[model samples]
Target: MECIVRPAQSADCDHLMGMIREIAEYHNLLDEVKINSQVLSADGFGGDPFYQCLVAELAPEQEGKQGQGIGKKLMSEVAKLALARGCVEMKFTVAEWNVRALAWYRQLGAQDKTEAGGWHCVELGGEALQRLAGDRR
Candidate 1:
């Protein structure tokens, strides 16, 4: 099956949302998903977009193909976009428990910043975010 990778259009929001929910569910974080297709469309296609997304659609002619180079192709396209935007690096997070993904990324030449650079990913959100914003002293 041939995978056609391209920039995601606004019309693809529903399909994208489905994929997002599937990933979140796979990570056992489905409850953490707070956005819907409406929010996705607004945040991704509205003025001053926060991020860009790519979609890889497989040709439907082939039925039972798996473990192909689709992931690598998607990542390659992402790298091209990052380079075009003059980005110094491309970074993403994956659960440490996902050994398969970790191994795959390592094979793809991705460095483990958490291990080598002693970096910690942090989050400040929900009520904590509101509290911090309201603190003006």
Candidate 2:
């Protein structure tokens, strides 16, 4: 299957959201995903945009079959978009357990800063965040 990478449009909100949900689920982060079609469209196509997404589609090869090149294509496009949007660099985090993804990102020239301590990540989960939110109410 041939793959074609392109910029995402407002019409692709549903498909993008579906992909996002799938990825989140794959990473055991389904509960952390709160994105919907409306939110995706508004955030990506609205004023004061937070981020952008790239889409991959079949290039009409061999009975119009599409393949799974979306992730790579999207990564490339996101990097380009980030640079174009005045971002000095782009950043993404991968779980320490996701070796496949980590390898792929490294292959794409993403540096592994695991030893640098330049980045700090804070995650709220397992009822603590919930309790905190509830206590504030």
Candidate 3:
């Protein structure tokens, strides 16, 4: 079996958007999706790029196989990119109830930061963000 982990391009926006919706559906949050493929393409490949991401594409014929490892491969590539970009740490949130994701990340030496280092994952979005900023519009 073979796989590829590569930098995302504008052409991949649609596929990535599909995956995002799929994941959102898996989490029962499909209604929260507000962005589309165009937004993803511009933000990712625009003049003032906001972020970087990697894409993993597995061999189409590799089915009924054990240990696909597509995600680990993608993360390894992203880790390299982060290091090259002078980042100290990589961060992303996973739903605590997603046992498979939790186990996979733990296997890669990730820890619950709150437990290990007394760090917390905090977020403020939408109304909370505007309220905190004292913006009424």
Candidate 4:
């Protein structure tokens, strides 16, 4: 039951893409996944990287089980990287209906900033993004 949490490599793009699709499917938002493995690799490993990613690799024989410390280890690695890069805080969003994930994040000392700090997560994409860009002209 040993899990290794490490930085993701370009070679992991295919596997990561699969995992991404799995989560999207779980949330019933498969159609929202527009990026493919190539995009994932470029975005994460390009000269100007958009984000950093960590991968948790478990033994081939081990079943992907929950309630283990694997997630905690991955988060710990992420926190270390953030701290090393002088980041003071980290933020992520979870679907409102995902009670289990919300509770687990809370257990990991994550706060509901949307509620406690009156923060709102906003996005503008696709046609809206194009329109906004056009307006700047």
Candidate 5:
């Protein structure tokens, strides 16, 4: 099978949104995805682009299919795009439970800076967020 990786365009808003929702669903966080097509287009291809995305499409796979190479190709394209955009580096967070993704990132020479205390992320959602808003009271 042939795999193609390419930078996203404004016309790809719907497809990109679908992929995002699919990923969110895979992580069991479907309800947390608030960004729609317009938001994605604005953030990615707007005046001040925040970030970029690369998509991998499989042309056709014979008898048995393998996705490893395709994934690597996609990452390679993403890295190229990042460098072209004058980004010193690209970063993405993965859940601690996703060992496979972690391994893949490591294979691609991604550093595990979690131990450096350089990055911190805070998320508020679900019932905890409701309680924080005094909604239960």
Candidate 6:
């Protein structure tokens, strides 16, 4: 399968969301998903785009193959995207127990801050996020 990693367009909302759900399901966190395609398209393609995305998929003739370096290609493209966006560093959080994903990341020369530098991953979302934003006034 010749996998092509490419920048995602607004038309890819459904497929991209499906891939997101797939990953969420893989991590046993499907119930945590709340965003829909409209939000995805807006956040990804709105007046003020929040982020960029890349998609990796098997070629049309090879739709069902896994572990075919597609993900790595996608990540590689993401690295390029980050660089093009003038980012100096790239980072993503992985669950502590997701050893497979951790290994894959390591293979890409990504350092695990938790294991290597004793850093902690933190988040402030939901009501906390709103409260913090509201405190600005």
Once model 2 is optimally superposed onto the true structure by TM-score, how far is the C-alpha of residue 73 displaced, in angstroms? 3.3
Off by over 4 Å in 3: 60-66, 134-137
Better of 4 and 5 by lDDT: 4
Write model 1 residue lDDT over 30-126, tens digit each, in one string. Answer: 9999999998999999998876899888777764244688888899999888899899887889899998888889988999899999898888999
Candidate 4 residues lying further than 4 Å off, grouped into runs, are none
Taking all chains together, the TM-score of candidate 5 against the true structure is 0.70
Better of 2 and 6 by lDDT: 6
lDDT of each: 0.88, 0.78, 0.84, 0.92, 0.81, 0.86
TM-score for each predicted model, relative to the true structure: 0.92, 0.71, 0.86, 0.93, 0.70, 0.88
- Per-residue alpha-carbon lDDT of model 2 for 1-137, expressed as tens digits? 56677878999999888888988999888999877999889998998888766777775554422235667776777777778878887678788898988888888788877746666566798699889888955
Model 6 weakest 10-residue run by lDDT:
57-66
Q: Which pairs of residues collide in candidate 4?
A: none
Locate the minimum summed-lDDT window of 10 residues in model 2: 59-68
Model 6 TM-score, 2 decimals: 0.88
* Clash pairs, model 3 backbone: none
- Clash number for candidate 1: 0
User: Candidate 1: lDDT of 103?
Assistant: 86
Per-residue lDDT of model 5, residues 1-137, tens digit only:
56677778988999888888988998999998988999889999989999877777665554324455877787788778779979899788888788988888898898867756666656798799888999655
Sort order, TM-score high to low:
4, 1, 6, 3, 2, 5
Location of the lowest summed lDDT over 10 successive residues in candidate 1: 58-67
Question: What is model 5's C-alpha RMSD?
Answer: 5.3
List per-candidate RMSD values in Å: 1.6, 4.3, 2.6, 1.3, 5.3, 1.8
lDDT of 5: 0.81
Model 1 ranges off by over 4 Å: 63-66
Local error of candidate 2 at residue 123 (angstroms): 5.3
